[model samples]
Target: MAAPLDLDQLQTFIAIADTGSFTRAAEEVHRTQSAVSMQMRRLEERIGKQLFEKDGRVNRLSEDGERLLAYARRMLRLNRETIAAFDDRRLEGHVRIGTPDDYADRFLPEIMARFARSNPRVELSVICEPTVNLVEQIRRGTLDLALVTHDDEKGQSEVVRHEPLLWVASSNHAVHEEEVLPLAVGRPTCVWRRAAIDMLDQMERDYRVLFTSWSATVIIASVISGLAVSVLPECALRPGMRVLGESDGFGTLPDCRIGLMRGHTGQPAIVEALARHVSESLDNITLPASEEAGMFDFAAMMAMRPRRHRPNMMPGW
Candidate 1:
């Protein structure tokens, strides 16, 4: 008969093998060194094989340990899957969601609050990154769903919501022909940065990049401090920022498309519910005239109309 294996012991063994030091493994597992050593000893006894070799002060995984690592990973994954399958009805499965920093800051809190209320047992895992990174993660099956900006030049994915980009700057900054506009931007993969640069180029405006960061907070802070101009969704702008002229002469920077993309085949109903909630939240975003007109859908307007209006009967009647 195969020996019974303990997951905790296996985890400790893997940790020790990876770190090559009991102290490090213990720290990683939030256990004392003696505890880690005890677990490893127990694991070895159960398997009836030496899994590690002590060379001086360092510990190295033996050939048997190397072979068992693969089995350990498979067993752990299966164990987790089994637990999730049984516990899913209680809203306890892990959900991996990806979103850009701007949308995450502006809208995620409210959505998460609503989701939490409905799915009290779910564990939400969020990854905030640029649209490109999020899309890649979604494609790679690392993320369960993503809220990402669409590339206009590229075909659309399953679109959930579409909003337009807007140019914004500090309230104190003035646009002038002589003065060089300082621009704050995110990293290269950011769609907003590309739009900002394209707008500046098309308008024959000379601008200098003053700050660049992947963080929305950093970009907004730089703009708020009167450091630079940036292009962002109208919904992302806070109170202190001012719109630089209404001239669409900068050209349409393309609509910001948000979508829910599943990583692989099977998705929990809770994940789909969260995706729908996110799509619904996008409806609440107010847009400027130019942006609003661009994304206007006849179906949405029809839905907003009052279905029936009854006139009050005259008192004489």
Candidate 2:
């Protein structure tokens, strides 16, 4: 007869795989590093194979670990769904969500505020991280939901919204003629960076990444100050930025797909509600008209308004 697997050990193994550090995983699971190590050892002994290679500074999954990740994810998701099914009340517990920092700063506040109005009793915890990190956290049960860029190679999740990607630069910056295209890009694994680079490569354009940061504000600031250019969602552009003219050979970049993803669980009400709110909010967003003919004049009213700090102002406010 086959031996029964230890659920606790499996959870530990999954945590280690997701976090890539035993110490971090131990802290997340509320166990000591030694305890996490012992659980993994016991799991490996039962399975008769080493799940991870501990040679490097960071713990890397072995062939066995990679093979078991799918099963572990399925089992954990099922466990959570089963528990939720029994406690099918008004979702009074906490719902932890993760999003890219840009999305959190730009669009998430309004959606969350609306959600709060509807579910006042439910607690919401939002974490802002890179898309890859957020996806890993969701898979590891650390987050209840996440909105990230959908990669065709990685497959689609439950799509919430999809918007066109637009190239933007400062109004004062010259297009196509600049020696090295100053680009403000997010960190590695950013979809916008990949899309921008791929488009530039295909067009045979010479460019240099002058600035790279994970903050959308940094990207906007650099572009507004005429220091760099960036590509972002059409809805994210603000005043003082300009979309390059197509006559300058700046057009033809492809669109990026952004979506909401959640683990398979029976709590469809919350997911559906959140999805509806996001879709509606994004659809209603209107970008300012372009100043130049055929090109979006994103800086049309740059002088009309002063940047004021309004505490408690939500996104889209």
- TM value for model 2: 0.59
Model 2 C-alpha lDDT per residue in residues 1-317, reported as the tens digit of each score: 98888878888877676555777778889998889888988888998997776543445677788778657865764565455556546456567777777777667866786666556656778888878887888788777778787776787465545566777887766643686676789876787898889888887778898889887788889988888878877656766677664655765555666777885545567766566556545533333344322344644323221221111111110
Best by TM-score: 2
**Model 1: per-residue Cα lDDT over 167-248, one tens digit each:** 6666665532226778888878677788888878887788888889988898888766777778776557665575554342
Total backbone collisions for each predicted model: 0, 3
Would you give me the overall lDDT of model 2? 0.68
Instruction: Report every candidate's CA lDDT.
Output: 0.67, 0.68
TM-score of each: 0.57, 0.59
237: Cα error in model 2, Å: 0.7
lDDT of 1 at 176: 25
**How close is each model in CA RMSD to the real structure?**
22.9, 17.2
Q: How far is candidate 1 from the true structure (C-alpha RMSD, Å)?
A: 22.9
Q: Tell me the spans in candidate 1 whose CA falls farther than 4 Å from its real position.
A: 1-90, 175-178, 247-252, 285-317
